[model samples]
Target chain A: EIVAAIETALGGGPLAGRRVLVTSGPTHEPIDPVRYIANRSSGAQGTAIAGALAGLGADVVFVTGPAEVPPPAGVQVVAVETAAQMAEAVRAALPVDAGVFAAAVADWRVASASDRKLKKTRDGIPALEFAENPDILKTVARMTEGRPGLVVGFAAETDDVVAHATAKRARKGCDWIVANDVSPATGIMGGSENAVVLITADGVEDWPRMSKAEVAQRLAARIASALGG
Target chain B: EIVAAIETALGGGPLAGRRVLVTSGPTHEPIDPVRYIANRSSGAQGTAIAGALAGLGADVVFVTGPAEVPPPAGVQVVAVETAAQMAEAVRAALPVDAGVFAAAVADWRVASASDRKLKKTRDGIPALEFAENPDILKTVARMTEGRPGLVVGFAAETDDVVAHATAKRARKGCDWIVANDVSPATGIMGGSENAVVLITADGVEDWPRMSKAEVAQRLAARIASALGG
Candidate 1:
């Protein structure tokens, strides 16, 4: 209560009355009871973004997978494991001022996940069947009602990041797309700093390589100003 | 330094003069510049085992993937990210008294990993082809020269835990197989407590549900006794 009073008295960074939703980490799509498909997302960027939003006094709902880093303080955290669970959590945290889909959600999941541990036999190795996962960003972006005022997505690309992200922005029907070059040579996939191109309706804006926290603060400020804070 | 001296003075449990190798966490196999396939192993049990062995005064080589927890102190930590790299590390840490194959190694990797990030095209979502990963435990257990005296494997099973693990012990040809039920109801996948059955040539030993640390200590003790420490 004292912290809330202080934030209110100091005018609370801007976006004070707004609520935001952010998704981070890689979803684990189960192949069986013990094994699942996952990615190398440490959830550094998404966690930073949630902290930045909360620092700005926004009501933040952070839907995260089994993140390597712990979730930030002062936010509503709903932990999930699989992509399907993450999508459901995102939908449940809807009707916000903005939604940032930064999670590295798996595009496919085992179609027939086994109830038992997969056995290696004399017959041969097990062959897994896969099915496509639901597109969470597109589903929320294409929402006819109860959609967030601003919808943002992330594109982790290796070649021609700007071009690919621009195309992705249109196809996903999201307001903005933050794209990055994740080539191994760049050492950025699980790194601390990031260089991104923010693709908005106005134009593409290139951001210098900076810490994830800086990126989050800049994005939060832009969102506040756009929301007439 | 004081802690090390104290352990050294106490003769460090039963496995004081022995050496052991342990693998932990999930391996990531790349599909593109930014995306990869992974698993949900947290490396908690493996980390505990490493700590326990070190407490027992064993020269421990901890080869781990991108584990959630930091490696235990007073041990050689060889960090890796993919199943192939982990296999290489395990081989390099050979000539030990015991080897614990606890990592949730991915069964497959993308056969033709793209040098560039996979773009979502108008044609459709991309199709990924997988190739089987090498059987690390089996290869070591079947080694002709400089093999560990005792090789322990872990099986995370959903159903028929003891039966499957017994079969696994014969198939892998390892000294012992520690099997656990990782069904969702058990809450053992990412949980702190574990219930495991130790399958050895003598028979199956059912262990009560306990903390990961206790499991590690008990397993380490068993390894020490088997290794004639």
Candidate 2:
């Protein structure tokens, strides 16, 4: 790791002159001033990937939500709370060599979010309306102008992991999709270990369960190669 | 602090031989396997209070939800995820001398929570149904048998702090209510300092803004006095 950092400092790695963008963590959609809807992602895998990319000499821009793990030391961190804010941040950090969308963003947000805390009344529970959040990965991948050279999306699926991820890659118009089973029994959502399936135009490759850092390093190397660095 | 620990070890403080129950943190109500609802409580105040009570030689059973701050040492910690589990834990630690309900428990949980992660489909947004959660403080305070000598509740209010908390005290039948303005402007919801108003049978006493640790120590001392320690 020290050697990698020294090499990056000397601008000597394969990705020396490349700039990359990574979005990580779970976006919190607020229902009220005090309460919010969140996901189980701890951002461990995303943070590790950002660190790995930076270690390989890529100037990384990490747009993150309120994650349990702190951001890596050498990346430009843009912290956000909601899907809208994350999308805005991603738009602002554009024209990179590659884009990695790893955040577990909420599909919908409470359309009727309240400024005041909702109280229980004799009338009964309040009705919560919902609205769709921005599809950040698809927006970036389908961009016609100034799009990243390679766009990689992530799919956290409970069932039909490969099929879901493969479909996601096509639907989002991304170059690659890193798929994982995040079922509670799998313990991959917040755990240190991950087992991922890489889905590309060519085919699928299932990687064995390993530490998040190892998965990140392997993925970063693949990205470096794909970017022709 | 070391003297306090030594005194507690020697059973020399005023609260020696007393058994206290303290509930802290924010309860997470799951909406699905990957998504859930949470609040902004960091649990700093509640953790400090538990530590202060233990410092005074009390035997403390700390019932906590998912909190940012860890449980204090010298107390038996019972960790829980949701309000229902927290209520069950509180019920199990019964017959104590006093009970401090400091947890920012969710009043409502998604009754329509799915076992599987909800996907975005052509069906538009999924409708969410809510149900009232167990009122832990009120349930314990209104207990007919095996009731603690004193029951204390907390209110995090955005407006009319004293009036709301005073009404809560009457409604819940708790002995006292520790009320605070948690409006975002005050920065008290997740910040270190607090300005609170204590509502009792006598009247409302507004405490000046102070560090959370100081507030905890003062409240612990008050509890000791109320219990005739």
Candidate 3:
């Protein structure tokens, strides 16, 4: 740890003097004071990515939700609960060299979320109205000014992984897309290993299944290369 | 730990030869393959209660959800995710001397839960249809043939704690109700210390704020006395 800090201080690594932003974990959308909607993201991969970036001497800002895994060392950590909170935190951590949007942000939130716990009534079960959450990746990617040089988005699809991710990359106008299949059979949602396909302007590169840390290391190296470090 | 085990084997302590059932944690109601509804229950109090009962030489059957706190040692642990699974698990561990329903089971589950991840579309956000979950506490409490001699329900209320808990006890036909205010200001929802009110046919007993372990020990002693252990 001390050696890494010293190296970072001396600007020794390829990503030295570069600033990067990462959003990790699963954003929780509240239904009431006590209840919320959540996903199966453990933040293992995202945490690993932030650690790898820091190891390469990048000053990292990590905005995360309620994750099972803790934030990595040597990064500015901004902890948030809801998707809206995460979006605000991301906006506050702007103008970085690269932005990695890895968090499993909810698509919609409870529009009629109650401040008080909803009681079971004779009428019937409560109907939960929905409201769309802000598209953080697209907002950052399409920014005309003060935008990160490289905006990498993640696509966790259950079917037609390549097609869905490719479409997502184009729709969001992101520089690259890290796509993965999160079907239960894959055992990758909360698992240590990840099998991902990287989609860029050139084409797709299917990466073999490996530990989340290894994936992070490789991705960090690619980011360094892309930024002409 | 060895001493406790030896004592339990020798049928020692006040609750020797007795069997007790406990349900702990917050039940998750799935919204989709990756998303679900959850609460802020850490299961600290419930785990401590189960441990205390086991320490009193009771054969403890602990049915728990995906809680932050792990189940106590020296108990049969039945892990579950949703309220339906928890209800089934509770039924399977029945015929005990006492039953404690401490889990914050969801009142409703998403009836329109999807097998596949719902994608964002131009149309709008998805509306969630809710269905009432089985009332586990009331079901067991009203069971005529094989109901536990001592049935205890829990009420996590934000307002009118005593009145709400008293009504809950009567409505569920349970012998006792453990009530606590879980308002965000209380800091008791996910905290170690708790201030609770115990409601019974005799009336309400307001307990001073204390560590969850202490509360559990006291409650277990009361259970032992009521069961004639």
How accurate locally is residue B225 in candidate 2, as Cα lDDT from 0 to 100? Answer: 96
Question: How would you encode candidate 2's per-residue C-alpha lDDT over B43-72 as one tens digit per residue?
Answer: 999999999998998999999999999899
> Per-residue lDDT for A1-229 in model 3, tens only?
4665577678778789899999999998988877889987999999999999988889999999999999999999999988899999999998899999999999888888887777777798766788888999999999999989999999998999999999999999999999999998999999999999999999999999999999999999899899887
Candidates in order have lDDT scores of 0.86, 0.92, 0.92
TM-score of chain B of each: 0.94, 0.97, 0.96
lDDT of 2 at B72: 98
Candidate 2: regions farther than 4 A off? A1-6, B1-6
Model 1 chain A weakest lDDT span, ten residues long: A1-10
lDDT (Cα, 0-100) at B147 in candidate 2: 90
Worst 10 residues of 3 chain A by lDDT: A1-10
What lDDT is reached at residue A42 by model 1? Answer: 81
Clashing pairs for model 2 are none
Selected candidate, larger lDDT, 2 vs 3: 2
- Model 3 whole-model lDDT (C-alpha atoms): 0.92
Q: What is the TM-score of chain A in candidate 1?
A: 0.93
lDDT of 3 by residue, B1-229 (tens): 4765677678787788898999999999988888899877999999999999999999999999999998999999999999999999999998989999999999989888898888866788666778889999999999999999999999998888898889899999999999999988999988999999999999999999999999998999899889886
TM-score of every candidate's chain A? 0.93, 0.97, 0.96
Worst 10 residues of 3 chain B by lDDT: B1-10
